[model samples]
Target: MSLQALWNQFLADPGRILNDLALFFTLAGAWLLLATRRREQRATARLVPQNEAQAVALDESTARMNRFFYRFGYGCLMLALLVSWYSTRL
Candidate 1:
């Protein structure tokens, strides 16, 4: 197909374009939030003394948060992929 025909075909489905944009924004937001949380944790960890129980607790919490973030982030990605696939098939 010609470039013009491809452009026309893309424009014919405004919904797919919008869904892709929304998914992009969602992934971006998730990444930003994860980065911010990691930075905050690092700063906070520096303030706590190495010998304290609180430091240990903080380390555990950080690990848990990291794991949760990865799991949740991947779930969102899978959902976005499903949505994109479904949109294209519609």
Candidate 2:
């Protein structure tokens, strides 16, 4: 289908959009968390690097990753809540 057709389809069913958003975020958040965990494991398994810069970068990466996934997870959940609220109003 064309892009416009797809957009029109989604608009026709507002609840479906919210549900799809919730599902997408749930999956994306879980994957981000898992990937971060794996990266942490691999980081520890590696021998200490001669450069101090690498350690600093790793710490920064972990913090950023955690924040992003946490926000993403919560935001999507909020969207699901919004959907429910909207349904009641309808």
Candidate 3:
């Protein structure tokens, strides 16, 4: 197809375009985060030699937050995929 025709086709379904963009960006961000995540950095900042209990709590909290972010990122990616696929098929 010609460039102008492709552009027109894309413009015909803004929802499809939006879904594609969301899918790309969401997965990209998730990949970047997973690639560079640093739990030790966060945990070290909260850990204190004088307070063992506080240190344990801080570690647990940090781990929980990390797990949450990972899950959220994966969820966004899956949602994006579903949206894109549904939009394209219709």
Task: Estimate the TM-score of every prediction.
Answer: 0.49, 0.53, 0.51
lDDT of 3 by residue, 65-89 (tens): 7777777767777777777776777
Report backbone clashes per prediction.
0, 0, 0
**Full-model lDDT for every candidate:** 0.69, 0.67, 0.69
Please identify model 2 stretches exceeding 4 Å from their true place: 47-90
Models, CA RMSD each? 7.2, 5.2, 6.0
Candidate 3 TM-score to native: 0.51
Q: Which candidate is the best by TM-score?
A: 2
C-alpha-based local distance difference test score of model 2: 0.67
Worst 10 residues of 1 by lDDT: 50-59
Runs with alpha carbons beyond 4 Å of true place in candidate 1: 1-14, 25-58
Better of 1 and 3 by TM-score: 3
For candidate 3, the 10 contiguous residues with the lowest summed lDDT are 35-44
**Candidates in descending TM-score order:** 2, 3, 1
Quality of model 1 by C-alpha lDDT: 0.69
Better of 1 and 2 by TM-score: 2
